[model samples]
Target: MGETPWDKGYASPPLGEFLTKWGVTGRVLVPGCGTGHDVRLLAGKGADVVGMDIAQSAIFRAEAFPAVSRECYVLSDFLDLAASYRATFDWVVEHTCLCALDPSERSAYVDSVCAALKPKASFLAIFFREVSDYSGTGPPHPISREEIDLLFGPHFECVQSFIPTQTYPSRPVGSEEVCWMRML
Candidate 1:
């Protein structure tokens, strides 16, 4: 796989705000962390953050970034993380990862997240609610509240869900939903 155009130089505004409000300060996992912007943010906030990406180039680029140089970057498939990682993370921060996966793999994504998080650990995510065009082909596949509920509801409890005022340029004003959930 090649580098994605979605690899932004900075973390998304919603992610920044989430970190500010939540004060994530323990072991954290950032799956599909392309370029590690989010991982850097979490690590800067005193969390032991591990940024994981399937692409070796992405992990290399993430580790090369001066902002995240001290942070850990792993080249591994999120869906098949090491067994030792199970129930190890205090929090999981997701940005574009869920939307980037094929819709068919969403259940697996949720399972992977559940396996990685500690009991009652928080899962903070910014989901892309709408796509500019719905032609069905996308790295950023469109998602909805119903879909989120269906995928994560069984294993996690929805703590909060709201439309974020701040978002990346690629997403529209109301196209993103910031959801906070806790593993059950």
Candidate 2:
């Protein structure tokens, strides 16, 4: 395959910074983890991380990298996670996963994340709060605070939420948000 527009070739800078302070451990799940960049980040922090992606090529590419710990890559749909993964993860780290889901599938995505985490487990995510799309149609969908509250507030308690000062070079400052939510 040719160059992917979204491929960062490394773990997200914000994620790396967060993990540095998070002291991550236990089982972590990364849905829509292309090439396992973020997956390896948590693994290096001593967490047993699993990276799940729908693309076989992504998994193949991830496996080609030198693993830091018990990190594993799997080819599977995040929307239809395996039974073994149900309520098994202590953390579900989201980067671009949320924006990739269609608006209609957002509920399903939320359900899947709830199912994937143990009770009271944390779900940490960096979401696109605003994008350049005029029609509001996108894989990189922009989400607002009200929409997040409407979608996740019922099932989770917000531990922390903030707008990052540092973001990807292409993204405008304050266009991204990070939320640390715990399962109810």
Candidate 3:
């Protein structure tokens, strides 16, 4: 898969605003954190944040960002995260990561996220609803509300789920599903 242009910018506006409004603090984990943009944003908000990506180059680029110097960045696959990381985060933020995975791997993704979060910890995610012409040929595989609920409901309780008025320029206005769930 080609590198995503998303790898070069600050956190998406909706995500940044959500974290700011919620005042999320304490240990947070960002899996598939392309270049630590969200990591920097979370750290600036007083959250002890760690950004993890399977790509070594992404980790190197993240490490070079002075804004993330005090934060942690790891090179590792989320599905294969170390046992020591289990139940270690107060929050696990999911931005574009979920849609980036193949539909088949979503179950593993949910398992990894659950394993990494503390009991009752929060999982914040923004999922892309399918567009009419979506062909399923992408790093950003389209997702639906039902699929999301089915994948996470067994391990979490839905706290909030809605379509965000704000979204990235590349996406449609009502195409994103934003959800906040607490680990069960």
- State which candidate has the highest TM-score: 2
Q: CA lDDT of 72 in candidate 3?
A: 93
Off by over 4 Å in 1: 1-3, 67-70
lDDT of 1 at 127: 90
In model 3, the runs with Cα more than 4 Å from the true position are 1-3, 68-70
Q: What is the C-alpha lDDT profile of model 3 across 38-66, one tens digit per residue?
A: 88988887889989999999899888989
Question: What C-alpha lDDT values do all the predictions have?
Answer: 0.85, 0.87, 0.83
Highest lDDT among the candidates is held by which one?
2
Query: Which stretch of 10 consecutive residues in model 1 shows the poorest summed lDDT?
Result: 1-10
Per-model TM-score versus the true fold? 0.94, 0.94, 0.92
Model 1 collision count:
0
Residue 122 CA displacement from its true place in model 1, Å:
1.0
lDDT per residue, candidate 2, 1-184, as tens digits? 2667778677877777676556667999999999988999888888999999999988999999997989999899999988999999999999998898888889999999999999999999998888875377677788889999999999999987777766668777778888889998
| lDDT comparing candidate 1 with the true structure | 0.85
